[model samples]
Target: MAEKPGSQEAHLSSSDVSAGQLVQDWSVKEERRARRKIDTSVLPLLFLGLLVFQLDRMNLASALTGGFATDIQVTQDTINLGNQLMFLGIVILEIPFNMLLQKLGPRKWMSAQVFAFGLIATLQVFIRDRRGFLASRMFLGLAEAGYIPGAVYTLSTFYTRRELAKRVAILFFGMFGGNALSPILASGILKLDGERGIRGWQWLFLLEGLFTILVSITLLFLLPGSPDTPKPLLSPGLIRFSPAEQDILQKRLELEDNEKRGGAQGQPIPLKLVWKTLCHYRRWPHFVSTFAVFSTWSPLTTYTPSIIVALGFDRIAANALAAVGASVALIVVFGFAYLSDKTNRRGLSVITAHVCYLVTLIVARQVHPHVGKWSRFGLWTAVNSFAVGYHPVHNSWVQLNCRDPRERSISIAMWVMSAILGLMTGTQYFRGNDVPFYSTGLRTMIIMVSIGMVFAIIQVIVYTVHNRRVAEGKHTSSDGEEPMIYTI
Candidate 1:
């Protein structure tokens, strides 16, 4: 018997619906697998690169007491001048480096930076005087400039805004891990003093610099520009991606980009983009907050070893003890980043972290040397961990607010420049007279972090208001794109 016309129509519609659902299910499954592949393959390589970057950048701190100043014949003042010049180099070169990364892509540009900075770092072993030392530091800074921002911008291309914060934390965990591990590594290498008639500090530079160069060669062969193109320079077929996976990743990002910015995702940045990014008054709160928080690293990171040594420990012991704070930082940074991503509450997480930092700084400043050294050490660890915890949240905030890719690239560069400028002021914080306690520097850090908290508050308020406006359709997007409604 023939089926009725109504029954036939109903059967055809149900079959179409089932077919669509099956396709959707398959796409979702493929995306999950692809993301897992990315997590394992891509993130670890990026983490390694960041680890190399931080090790090279922060080795100078470990070298301070290992006869660096004595061999170079520089006073604390001269060392401070060198630090200032280094940051000045970073400040001057960061934007250009970021623009170059945009032009050349991450693989070639980032690899070249690592190699150049590695060579500069290795050259440090030849510095015979304060002038030579200063020049090497400046050259190192110039070579390392834009690395963090460039890495961040590159990662943003692969991950969604939500997936970014935790990945950023994992990447920065390399820095914290380097801070924790480099002390041990440097101290062990310092034991190689007088081997081949080279000073321990000289060996430190030579070995660490060589490690950076080796890593750069690996990166040159591993990292391709985007997820779509997995072809590394030499690896040819190393990172194979199925067409289905590519379609899912690309389509997902396009959908997200459309929702966030009316599909203004991959447009070339205008020449006036920097001027426009700089003038966005709403972004200033984040900039101020980033600068204030990052500025603390000058006295905090650069001087931690010095402070420990001044507290009656020898250089090796001081370096070992400094690792404790870095250990704490690694824990807090990962934990805080996990929470930030889970809650989608960037501003609250940052403000809370800094508030904890403010308390720890106060306690560290109040610890009396005559009483006990352990209290001072504990408080310093707390301060370091809390301070480091604020970074991933702050970075994600800036990137999310500037949804456009080109805008994000330029804005990240500007943010990094602001951080470099803030850090340049760091050299002045620890003067020759500051010595053991550096009480004034500690107090200055407290005040600066407090100011940063204020900026964090302002950032939350502005972003909240802006989100509300977008929700209510009161104000359109500033860039003539769709207004994105997101939580801070």
Candidate 2:
């Protein structure tokens, strides 16, 4: 069963007396050890789910490298439309599935989602036409829609604000790890094209989708449900938390919320609250910045292998090489997260990531038409490496700005939806006309990222102004949940 917030909410809040008091009683060493336990038990399962989610969601590009387009006889334009429809499914169901999370709980609903999409992904191996491919992609998106944000929200409940930034970075490793792993896996699996009377792309989808279905079973039994229900489905034999550790896990977050939000935890946010947060102007900059920034990523993920192959590399080597930048991205993500936690500057970390990415794009677009193939490959690698580094920091920063638990969930949902929309928009940037170089698409991305940077700057300025008001007792947050601090 998916764990819902109920009796545990009051129980947890009653234990916290004031801001920071609940945490003070727990020794720093003791808490750290307990946190390590939670990380091992909870984070890995979450990471694994996302790894498969991203693999299933993004494998079409990898399949293209294995001759997906030739077998299906779909043009690049049709393929791009498939990707867009997939993201559209995700966008359509993002909020509705989130609403479902409240009813079904994270574990049950998320596990069901894993299985739903896994089956759809596995079935994709049979598609021989454009409509079938497009339909499968859309259904895959529907299955994957709310999983990311829902996972992030559940993660928020398990750790304190201080602990969240780094954990968020770690959790995202699953996605970035998949980005790196997908191509490598496809490169290997694709070699078995004729082993069982299957094409290379068919083997790619069949193996990867079956692997994801197996993971769905693991998710159903191992996800720990929630902080209150910290013992996972197979607890006594495999993963179990002490009562003391569970107490620390759930209460630390409760205390953090009580101090910042003046509110309780482990409850569903109302639909009106959802509407209110949607209309809240303070959070819009993050959404806009996310939209602009994430839009830069879609074409990169969908085309990097193709781009490298265009550099005259072997298709197999191209698929394997595509993982390089994504591999590098894992480190970039962790570095930004560590810096944000170390320096206490989420804004600075995110801004620096955005700046670095924009500069990298500027460099890539400047690449001479006659540059060496390997050198161009290197440039694309660097671009993909820096592509998503800002994302986790941006996610943590967004969380820091919200007023209460309910708004926190709603805001995170908004951020994920906006980012997905951005990805969907970016799929079209590198059109069929762009061909191998995609120089025009690079320029378009530069413009979009520049716009994203502007929104990021606007967010910083807004937060800076609002922080002063908060210090002066004029925090203008809505009445439902009061934002005590605005992080800049």
Candidate 3:
């Protein structure tokens, strides 16, 4: 029988196609039960890995206020260069490493990479020159390259698209926690200046690096595999799910994909998948927006403590105080993610978060120099509070626009690479040359942030137009197959 024009049944292969109705078909109660199990089993451990990832990399900034530069005989400019090279390393290897992760499975690959980076992170303690510092940064970046995308890919296999944003937001709390905690920890640890003849920064690296190594071991035992491969690397059915639960976990995702793919499912060859995913122009704004917005973070994160100190706080006080805003950001980002999931409005959520951040920045830039020290501190906190709240929401949005698992992997890798590239460019924003000119740094941040916001709006328009085409049946496969629907 021929399908009628503009009928949802034209695309819905299943009797129920909307996510809400599909949830009913999958059994709302059972989906909830399985998700609860997966949540407790999966998210916490991923958060641990992310926590350490943030700590391992961000410890450098904390080390700066602790005389790390003097010990290594390097200047702030050289440190910036090393930071730039570190992100360059991640960008170069992100895609290839993520592919390896998919091939080998996250169990063996992610576990091994965590251990590898932990070793590199600890080895930074021995660096006494510019060369060694540079070498450590590069090696650490290489080791950490694919972990984010790998985790996201793994999470995708576990959860439905609608559930992804909140989970991702939860996962990223690990990073935010690290950002908030690292400085506070450093303030106390840096006071151990000559403990056993080790400088404070060395102690910081050694203790934190060893802690990450232990976390790697813990994750090996605890991190759950896919629904079918339900055991962690070293576990013997420890985090195991029942057969019925596993069925729910895997089948729900497959069903959701069917609903989205409609009747136009064409499995592209590997090379073709790569090409098509790369050319999916609707996804470009996600990448560009990530690049621009994420660029604004490196300078702020790398210098926030120093900025605080410049506001008349002592180094130790600055380190502890720098954590305040990041702590608040956890609330902000989660609120955005939760509301986005509840409303099923990814674009509006992301733009709202981005605009909030930009408003804070613009207000800060205009009022900053005129303010008193405490007022200056408040503005800086506001700017940091909104920093990167859109990140996880943006990630979920990108994942939604992808057509297949292979495309998803590639798209996520591209998004993460864009973020790393942004960080790389931002390392130069507050280099030694711009050190004294606070306004110069603020201006650079405002420009990058505005560019990102523009791209984010562009992404909304792209999604809107594509969704309209799908509704009208104008969006078609090259072979004139039915159009696939995208979640806007």
Name the best candidate (by lDDT): 3
Model number with the top TM-score:
2
Model 2 lDDT, residue 249, Cα: 68
Q: lDDT by residue for model 1 over 161-271, one digit each (tens)?
A: 789999888888877787787887887888888999999999999999899899888888877666655556567535666766665565556556643321212345667
In order of TM-score, best first, we have: 2, 3, 1
Better lDDT candidate (1, 2): 2
Could you give me the TM-score of model 1 versus the true structure?
Answer: 0.91
Per-residue error (Å), model 2, residue 390:
0.4
Clash number by candidate, in order = 0, 0, 0
lDDT of each: 0.77, 0.82, 0.83
Q: What would the per-residue lDDT of candidate 2 be over residues 300-392, giving only the tens digit for each residue?
A: 889989988888988889989999999999999999999999998888889899999999999988983768988888899999989999999
Candidate order by decreasing lDDT: 3, 2, 1
Worst 10 residues of 2 by lDDT: 1-10
lDDT of 3 by residue, 383-458 (tens): 8899979999999999887766777888999999999999999988886766543688888888888899899888
**Winner on TM-score (1 vs 2):** 2
Model 3 clashing residue pairs (backbone): none
TM-score of 3: 0.91
